[model samples]
Target: MASARKRKAAAQAAAQGAGGGVLAVKARYDAAGSGRRMRGWNPPTSGPNRAITGLQKIRDRARDAGRNDWSGESSTQHWTTNLIGIGIVPRLRRIKSKNRKQELNDLWDAWVSQADADGVLNFYGLQTLAVRSWLESGEVFARLRPRQIDAPLAVPLQVQLIEADFVPLLDADYWPGMPAGNTIRQGIERNKYGRRVAYWMYRDHPGDGQLSSAIDASRLLRVPADQVLHMFEPKRPGQLRGVSSLAPILARLRNVADFDDNVLERQKLANLFTVFITRTMPGGVDGDFDPLTNLPVDWGNDGLPLAGLEPGMSQELDPGQDVKFSAPPDAGTAYPDYMRTQHLGTAAGQGLPYELFSGDIKEVSDRTLRVIINEFRRFAEQRQWQIVIPMLCQPIRDAWVDAGVLSGAISVEEANDAKRVEWAPHGWQYIHPVQDVQGKKLEVDAGFRSRSSVIAERGDDPEQVDAERAADKERDEELGLFTAPIQPDPNRSDGDSSGESSPGRRPDSNKAKK
Candidate 1:
């Protein structure tokens, strides 16, 4: 007892030496306190802390859910279709020399056609794959492979896509050949100042073979940081890696899917029209009863019973034997409403509108749909510009230009001039075509928005659109075709046309104008 008291005193003294005394912090937030409501509410302090322990398991489950669950697939497809669409086409910007700009643009177009190291996917297709993988696996890597100078290519640069699995989440105090004072966290090597210096990656995917041996230092390749492109949407300030977009909703998706399957099975059983035979006495049973047909069962070659129900079939029952039909409960009328509510949660978790994600428009109105779609478009635009453009597309562009300059295919001056570029993502179709076009026209006419900006928003180059328009006009002139000048809608009496009502106007509008 005296030794125990001495030990406790020593511990207290050590605590006092470190600081003034043992600090007892009481959190003011009710949620952070050890209250009844806060029971089982322990959460990690940061994103990395939460992700570091079970990242691989989370990624594997997410990929499985994406493959199996409808909601998971919907989330991936919604982002890919909206954020990527056909492709985010590039437009060279602000090149003083028109000839140089055209040449650089043409060269870039050619290089992108065969950018993939495997020669299977183009650059834009790689973008789609990267985005899909990012959603599925949380993060993806691209190795910038500089080709030989004499290689037969427009630009001597190719991109090799690497899955997140390539980089092992190996947190170590000191790895083999690691510089002093640098620590490895989640497979990334960081120097003293916390700058990522390199990545420890496997030469081949560790999960590629079933008989894969235990990973060792020899199996890891230290790749320079600049050569690899890491694409992931970071949810925390100092997150070392990404967690799958489906991670948050995976359990919910599985629960919803299981419920749906159960409901389906219940409905199927409910419609089975099964009849059960009850026997009163022993030794009175003649043959096995078929639940499906309520007829005598026959054995097959495999010793399994085969039963059939034919129309107008009659069966004889022994004495004291009676038949009762099965009346299994259906999936209730609330099933549809319950499913809709569950799907809404999944859609919100995926950052998508319910209508777009689930393809359910039974309860959607035009105005409500318009609002939902606009909000979704804003979300997609943020992802495109912030994550995809800067992380994936711009780096590839810069690498292409550098390769072109190095390979002597492009002059240094031209490469420098063509550095500025604009990547335009595909535009969405108008919800109300006529109204949308008229609104754009009004905006353009009133100088509230520029015509160039309008064209760009439609995923077209303004200069190219103008040139196409000029060509069409020239062709019409050459063919002597009468082209009417664009005018305001005859039905519109919004005071822009002297409040005049012309042909095709409503009688009430004309009367009011008169």
Candidate 2:
């Protein structure tokens, strides 16, 4: 049977070769074809084209949903909470001079207190706002504003945040003159090599009627690309702009809201206790009965027929009359389950765990929660390292250093050296404090991790922590307080001079007496 199958395959290949060369596979992906399953699956393949045509409407719809819908608002808040809890603080990694590094740090702290161009938020507050905006609007921009040398700032630099609306997503060929190979696509002006040269932005927000009139709204400013920081997570290879994080789940959120409203309306109608009376004969109270339809002819003060029900009150029906109550349709027993499923989908689309998104942890065990959170932390770390740090924090660091040098606060020779920095983002809280701490201790004891690394992971500077610990220890000793001995070196021999024994070693009884 195997030989016959092989012979058949060889004959088919030979026939194909004889007809032409090797024939292309005629089969195609089912999803790519035009069957009923794929009929509504068509989406635009070009990211930039979509941005140019429909980005404004998409952004507006996303903002509307975010502002009005609870789940939509919660998703953006959760992202901001996780990504920029306190701030991604920067540490100078200068090895040549410790004093210079301290000076730079001091200057940074002073400047951070006044980093906002509008003077409304501090550096960390700006971070939170920037992350929130990026999540809600799909993109955020910051212009690096330079101040004079005599300005009352440690560093003559402040960041002015620009909303995504400031930059118009319109395509244009070179503004009619100078350069040949320059064209603007989606507000970003690129040269021949496709490197961004500038961004064409409105001087004032187009939506702010007070800030921009119809006459001044058309005026645009060409800002150098290097002077602006654009923060967004790009989904495609050449996506010029970002689409909202809420984009995928907008329709679902709207549907869920509508469903909730409908359910509430049903409950409201059910509470009215409306009753219908049917009569076999048309004889009843003359003023209360309609002559034509025999329905209620008396109208309430509010202009509607109302049947009032009072406790312990009974009314006798006429000779051949019956009464029945109207029942509004109720959301069935599956309503909660259906809502849970929809909420889970929304959370997943927003790249969040259901437990975090809904604050519903009744069904999740601790172990399961740990797994969910750890997976989420990995994603958060990726965003911190890949997007937040590189795009926002690092550029701000470089600009601060340059501005410091220009203002004579930092030496020109040390400007490049001072720019060597490492960012430590706000750390996550322990899932189970005691268990997590013990696990970390074990890792440290086994030499699998460093104490400095543990400190950094807890959202602290390792060197600063060590220095503070040393100061506390010295103060304790000077006040005649008991100082616990430091842990013995695991690699030290039994006869080591420090007089502390290794783990599990028996203390010398003779030494106690001496």
Please tell me which predicted candidate would have the highest TM-score against the true structure.
2
The residue pairs found clashing in candidate 1 are none
TM-score, candidate 2, is 0.85
Error of 1 at 420 (Å): 1.4
Query: Which lDDT value does model 2 have at 68?
Result: 94
TM-score of 1: 0.83
The superposed Cα distance between candidate 2 and the true structure at residue 92, in angstroms, equals: 1.3
Assess each prediction's global lDDT (C-alpha) against the native. Answer: 0.84, 0.84
Error of 1 at 81 (Å): 0.9
* TM-score on alpha carbons, each prediction: 0.83, 0.85
Model 2, span 26-102: residue lDDT tens: 35566666668889888876555564467677788888988899899999999999999989998877647888789
Show pairs that collide, candidate 2. Answer: none
lDDT of 1 by residue, 1-514 (tens): 9999999999999888666522332325566567677888897665554555788999999988888887888899889988898899888877877777778778888888889998899988999999999988999999999999988889889999999999988889888989999999889999999999999999888888562545589989999898999999898778889889998898988898888998888889787878766766556567676654445777899999887556898877676677797888878889888988998998999999989998889867999999999999999999999999999998888888888889887778767656668889998889999999989988987779999999999999999898898898688767766555445665656666643324334433445767
